[model samples]
Target chain A: MLRTVLTAAIALAPMAASAAEVVSAVLRIERERPAPISRLELPAGDEGFMGALLATRDNETTGGFLGHTYVLHKAAALPEDATAALDDLIEQGARFIVTLAEADDLLALADHAAGRDVLLLNVSAPDDRLRGVDCRANVLHATPSRRMLADGLAQYLLWKRWDRWALVHGSHPRDREKAEALRAAARRFGARIVSELAFEDTGGARRSDTGHVLVQRQIPGLMQGLREHDVVVVADESQVFGVHMPYRGWTARPVAGDAGLRATAWHPAHEGFGATQLQRRFEALAGRRMTDLDYEAWVALRAVSEAVTRTDTADLATVLAHLLSDDFELAAFKGMPLSFRPWSRQLRQAVILGDGFTVVSISPQEEFLHQRTRLDTLGVDEAESACPL
Target chain B: MRGFLAGAVALLALGPVAAWAQVVFVTNEKGNSVTRIDVATLEVIDTVPVGQRPRGITISNDGRQLFVAASDDDTVQVFDPETMRLIHTLPSGPDPEQFVLHPSGNPLFIANEDDNLVTVVDVVTRRALAEIPVGIEPEGMGISPDGRVLVNTSETTNMAHFIDTETFKIFHNTLVDSRPRVAEFTRDGSLLFVSAEIGGTVSVIDPASGEIVHTIRFAVPGVTPEALQPVGVRVTADGSRVFVALGPANRVAVVDGRTFEVKNYLLVGQRVWQLAFTPDERYLFTTNGNSNDVSVIDVAAERVIKSIPVGDQPWGVVVSPN
Candidate 1:
């Protein structure tokens, strides 16, 4: 299944001598192993952290002209000095850093890497300030914004006529911001928030004894008889009480948001449309499985690889220039061709909708017409984004 | 002159009558049913109820008995060609999805999906003689013409496991891309064509060495790569053209047998899973499970000449005897 084109990039013609020299771009990713964001469980079969890096690298390096390679530095959150380690990685010839970390942590790292000409990519963060008024010039994002995920979920809800929603939010800045996005989507799609309830994550021992009974009482009590709304949207990103909201704990009405209906980056059933081959290849190389982090790594690598394949050399400037140009076509195993947003350098792609084991649909949806592609409808359009650089 | 006229008349009377060549049988998966139709008349002649989820089907070499692998029932339901009755049942391996008959008409080779094994059964006794372990989710089964090797394609591990029929040992494990569902060896035993449903391409691999030499990519807009997948494949009698049933693409893609290059698409019914040809190689038939219809294609014309209505959710289909 492994098909290598084996391009002879070193033996090119003499006309391109004045052009940018081929510099090997190394991207070092610092993150947790087997990280779970929303519903994408990593290091499983098909896709995982390192596997994703290679997929993107392989895709971008297809023509072999671009000399960008992603080197992943994965470690658990408890054991390592993430910031110093990233600095050490940069000293070791890596000029780009992609991190799957807390919003504050990533911002600190980005600020530390500032003035050094090193770009820091925040793969998964819901911090509004990143894309809002406080966006950075060198920092890029591969994960869909919280607003985008909410809108992606709400489009289908709007389509299904589940207009009346009882909003339940967890106690977190990110969770509240996500709720704001949901509220905005609700307003835009003609949905009504009948009531708002806050579920504070009071950390205690694993609530195995009285958890189910307590959840049953609190959830049903908050909703008050179940007919008040068509859907109960829970915004709990901390994994606190999200799983307990379905079936017996919550209102009999169908659950949306974090647990019941989730929007994610990848799933196991995405094998159709030649995804399986990429997944299989990655799995074969990496003994452990792939995750969403792997996918982010993959996209980053692919971006560079694509530039090399399309342009003259594996030069950093040419690769960057090609990526910034509109003619760039990157295939990142999402069953479609993808392009980046000009303003924020955010990659526009489809968000997968899931309910436990079954994959429901991909959002931005097939019908979200935006003239050329429906994938354009997934994230912030160029006109709406505030990032000037 | 009177004696010569009498001899010519005797010779004319001695010739055999032409056998029927326009019939196709479709097996319904959920309905546990088999529908027989006259290809020329475009009519359902009979519908016989069989066992659970009848998937793999093949006609006996003599064309008298139709063998259907009833997976849930753990047996191959044998039907009488003329009456369309449940004549008998052949004991198959655990969870059979596909089966192939020996060239000598003595044994039946079956690919058991759940067990990851291929069972060789004695045709006369309807008993499994040997069960050889292959790979994960072994679905498609086919035998080489010279009766030397039996091939099984596994879905999960993405490999085609070739078994030496005499020793019943897995001699070669050819790693394909991903989710390889079906396999068929060329008539001359030179090439083994395996279709990967997930890979969305048919790989032409060497059966002896388990090396892939050629891969054909199938693509069309408005259709997913999953749908453009090559599943059931059949080569022409002359070995010039290969017809691959593109699952859910609603077409049978024709490829040059020698070059392994796709020629054109032959539009068929929806979700076309399996194919069968008549004894004379004049007509080709395919079962479209989703549309619940059987398409009869004129082999020479390369088009769906007629559609025969069949039972619900037809999966495995084959041609019976004259």
Candidate 2:
């Protein structure tokens, strides 16, 4: 979606000098092996990698005039140990890397790249720990933390006067973490959690015809004993049971969290603040709807690209310094210019609340006030973040 | 043809009185009406219901017609300014947020926000001439002083597409700040100022070179940067000062055109969306969406002299050519 025009300074430069002066920056995308199949339907394209490719194209549109050449190297289907692949990319002069890996794998890569001037951008994992006590100096996160997602949704629910929530979560580690964050958000936002229940993912084929019958019987039973609540918040990151609880809940309350009205980093239905142009461009490029992972990956790469284009250099130290500075701001069509939190390195962005068809609203509601930036209202602020860096 | 002839006759009938009295039209999005303000007396002279969600508005080059982009209705309703009557409706593409008329007075270029297309319509015939594909969320439209190059600022793409008027081809694209909502060409057409609502900066771009020469940032004490969203831009005829409507900040920043430094911040009403100037350039009027009012500023005094109440959510404003 990026269009560029050669600057007068660059256009007037001697052809020979310009040819020799192009600065090259290689971006590496490191992805671990696919996790075990859950109920989540996989996108047709490689989510994170496809996003990086689109970003590469977008960056190249303006990169040439700045004497910059961007190269993308994707490492996918890596074995359990991706140390060798990381080393190979580093050897190939890739100081910037976008990792579509889990927290443990990302930490391992950070350890491997320590003291090597390598900056890793986390675009997949939303682990709160990465932005908390386990934060790394060289790692920046584009993905919203689970706490951020929970707070975003809570802000909207509170705005709508839906203060009481029935919490239902699946039996998964991430699901537990998401539920914990939601509980924290409820406490912070003055909302009451009426009841809590855990839905164990009993092993079964999800698409079976009889599975619908079982879900219809099981979901209502799970909701039967819950106290009166204005909304049902489902925390099923494993995607096992959340989608089924929407209309099938015993009480006809609105559903939120992982299904029904959901809070996400990006949604195809978002058209406000000119997101329609981004959606159209992404559709033209990828031939599919842009997913949250794609948007995260694009933001990560764009951060690096913005840094390089502004600084007019490919030096890792300079780019990293500029990125961490207050002057660095990336406009990502989120109704606000996105910046990194120096403490958590989490990109501050607007969380979109959307159904499948249309965006219901955006978080950081008008009522959620912050002293510095309203975007700080959605996630951990510098004053409250546990990260020492 | 009939509408134009009737408008001409109406103009002839009100000739001397209308010439002396300048009127400003403000479109209220929520009220679905246009509020007319008399410049000499600074009063709400009339309120005419137009269509649904009327936002973008402008006067025809001849001063006889007013075009209002009723976004919800997806039509540009033209009205006779003198008689205050709806004349015709042109087929504007979906979600027409903003548009500009070509200097020749025949074609109207509109930014179709939902469809990512700039639709060109012959205002006289009310026939769509062409639909030029641009970037996402085209919201702001600007034409060069000579009327050769048309500028469309795409909100999402954050780029100003300089399209050739004759061919309707995008000759050059200059990337600006995020969520650009308005584009205004200096009177001389030497420079183009694009206001980025989210970025809170005004990018001054050179039209011929297609380069962003300077970026002007705003900072008001006690106002958060997030609330300093720049939505509307206006440059003086002499290009001495530039005024930017800071959306939620409830102020208009006046910057020195030569130095690009903020000279003064004139306090207005809440959520100021757009501005217009009197014919003699003695006064300026701002449409405040949240306050449902318009603030009148004396150009020489550089201060708001009066705040006149208008329809609900008054968004766009335009002054009659006469």
In CAPRI terms, model 1 is classed as incorrect
TM-score of chain B of 1: 0.90
TM-scores for all candidates?
A: 0.61, 0.78
Tens digit per residue, CA lDDT, model 2, B58-81: 987778889999988888999888
Lowest summed lDDT over 10 consecutive residues: which window, candidate 2 chain A?
Answer: A6-15
TM-score of 1: 0.61
lDDT of 1 by residue, A314-359 (tens): 5555566677677665545554545667677777777777887767
Residue-by-residue lDDT tens digits, candidate 2, A149-223: 899999999999999999999898989999999999999899999999998978665566466777789889889
Q: What is the DockQ of candidate 1?
A: 0.03
Question: Residue B320: error of model 2 in Å?
Answer: 2.4
Query: After superposing candidate 1, which stretches have Cα over 4 Å from the reference?
Result: A1-166, A173-197, A202-230, A239-253, A259-389, B1-23, B45-47, B81-91, B171-174, B188-191, B205-213, B224-226, B306-309
Against the native chain B, each candidate's TM-score is 0.90, 0.94
Residue runs of model 2 more than 4 Å from their true location after superposition: A1-42, A64-67, A78-81, A84-95, B1-60, B64-194, B203-217, B220-222, B238-241, B255-270, B287-316
